[model samples]
Target: MFEQLGLIGCGLMGGSFALALKRAGLVKRVVGYSKSPSTTERARQMGVIDVEAPSALLAVSGADIVLLAVPVAATEATLKAIRHLVSKDMLIMDVGSTKRDVIDAGRRVLRDHVGSFVPCHPIAGKEVSGVENADVDLYVGKQVIVTPIDRTQPEQLQRAVDVWQKLQCNVVQMAPEAHDAAFAAVSHLPHLIAFALVNGIASQTRAEDFLTLAGPGFRDFTRIAASEPKMWRDILLANRQELLEQSQVFQRTLKAMEAMIEAGNADALEGFITQASQLRANWRMGPKKG
Candidate 1:
């Protein structure tokens, strides 16, 4: 059990972490801070946090475990604010979708104290965001990737894994680079495609008319298009290189299928479709090393 959990951000991810920790009886107190005062106040009013900290530094004043649930872009500033109090004894983690940029920020801001910071990406969340939508079960049974850098303290890393495991999360650990590359292929690129797909259709003159006829397949495929714009924008930019590489691979495959269609080669097109269908049908979700 932790004496205090200093939660920064106080949005859906942060608030949900606090609620989950409280419900699991792992944290005795939660001190939360957000860039928006109203958000911090709302989190406190909703019982997501025991105290509303006025600043990021104050949030970690006496916290043994700290969670930075802010956007990837704000990581450096957040770490700079709280670096004065960061110590090897504290187990600090972030829930950013991208890891390399966050690790770099921790290294730069925390310096020698970087060992206390463990980069984490929880494969969980809803399309909608904010403190109001925070749910206690957000992390339950979710695959949380803990990406620890070379400078990370072993004891603190173990503590992070333990905390997530206690919260009923299937925790997996990987190096920061590997984590970024793998997620770029599986998560980031998919969101990018969904966003582009929606925008491409909406750009047409019959955008509204086309949407009116969209069925479950279109809705399901473009579900991630409704994700928080700012958050996804930061994620895509942060992991742009790897995401671009994945995009190129996807384009190549798409072009191959398009070529078959253009040539009117039914046999080749059918074979290609059958192969893709079989591959997707045989795919099983689970944690595997990068």
Candidate 2:
């Protein structure tokens, strides 16, 4: 636990951490700084942050812990702004959806302090966003991946894990590259598919009619499509390389399914559908690759 937590970006992800720390009695004070003044003020009014600093440097002035929860594209700039204030002994972590790019950003901006920056991605969020929507328990029972590089300090890595564990998260360790590849499949690909599916439907002449007749399946599949657009945009582009690979993999499967359907090969089509059904039905919720 730290005496003060310096939070950069007082949005849903960042505000939720401040709320979680306060709820768990972990940190004594949380000083937040967001690029938007109104956002910082909103976080203060929502009781998510104890203090709102005018600048990122002032936010971490004397803090022992710092967390960056900004957009993935903004990681380097945020780190650069506070690099001078980051101390060697301080514990630093990020709640990015992508790890490799974030690690690269740390390398670019943090330089000497890079070892203290333990790159992490908390696999939890809501379709809605903003500091007002931050939930103290958003991270509870959710997966938090810590991807440490060769340059990462052992002590800093352990401390980062401890912090997530304190918040009731299922902490898992993975290599940064593996983390990017896995999430590109499970997380990023799905979001891209959702956005595509929703937009595709809307492009048709009977778009409104199609949507009106849509039911639970459509709703369930496109639930994430309702999420913050800018956030997903950043995520999709940040992990573009891995996502492109995943897309190619998915394309192969889609073509195979289409081939079976077009050829009226009912048995093969059923077998294909059943294979996916069996996998999903048998898969149990447990700590994955921790």
Candidate 3:
């Protein structure tokens, strides 16, 4: 077990990591810090953290493992804050949604200690935020993507992977840029589309009237729109380049459907809808039998 875990950002992601570590008995104690005092206090009360640190540096002090679970935009400043406390033997990782920007921040702030940094993104979370909603099983069975940089220490990278493995996470490795690009399509773009669709309807003068008659499909599609706004805003902007590309691809599909509906082309519309339905149905069915 790691002697101590230094967790920065005591929000949902960070809080959940600490709980997972504790539940797995992989970490002896957790020292946590958040810019918001209330969050740190809440985390301590919730037992997500064993110690509440007043500053980021203090949080990492005497800790062998450090996790920065702050937003992608705050990576630079947060890393700069705790860089001095980082050591060669320490394992530093982040649960940021976008990796390239975070890896860039690590390069800028981590400097000599960059080898200890392993950029990670756990493909798990809910529509809610904060320590109050943190789940101990958040990472269990989730895809924990580790994007290692050239300067990453091989042993340290494996140690980071092991930590997640012990938590029952399915660890995967990829380049930082590729992680950013892939997640932008699957995770980031969906959130953006959800927000856009919800807002588009809400922007109409009769939005409230329409929403009152909305059903399960609308509720399921727009559930993500209720997610923390500032977090999604940061995610979209950080991965804007990749997200823009994904958005264009989605727009093309949308245009094709739009044209089919406009022309009342029954055969073409059926084909268009059928393809998507078949793909989604197959995915729901999981792997094919041998």
- Give candidate 2's root-mean-square deviation (CA, Å): 1.3
Ranked by TM-score from best down, the candidates are 2, 1, 3
Candidate 2 residue pairs that clash: none
Note the Cα lDDT for every prediction shown.
0.93, 0.92, 0.91
CA error at residue 168 for candidate 3, angstroms:
0.6
TM-scores of all predicted structures: 0.97, 0.98, 0.96
Write candidate 1's Cα lDDT for 1-290 as tens digits: 99999999999999999999999999999999999999999999999999999999999999999999999999999999999999889989999999999998998999999999989989899999999999999999899999987889999989999999999999988887888889888889889999889999989999999999999999899888899999999999999999899899999999999999999999999999999899999887866546
Candidate 1 structure lDDT: 0.93
The candidate, 1 or 3, that scores higher on lDDT is 1
Number of the top lDDT candidate: 1
Where in model 3 is the C-alpha error above 4 Å? 284-290
Over the stretch 125-215, how does candidate 3's per-residue lDDT look in tens digits?
9988899999998888888899998899999999999999999987889998898888888788999999889889989999999999999
Instruction: Report the lDDT of model 1 for residue 72.
Output: 94
Q: lDDT rank, highest first? A: 1, 2, 3
Candidate 2 has its poorest 10 consecutive residues by lDDT at: 281-290
Return whichever of 1 and 2 wins on lDDT.
1
**Candidates 1 and 3: which is better by TM-score?**
1
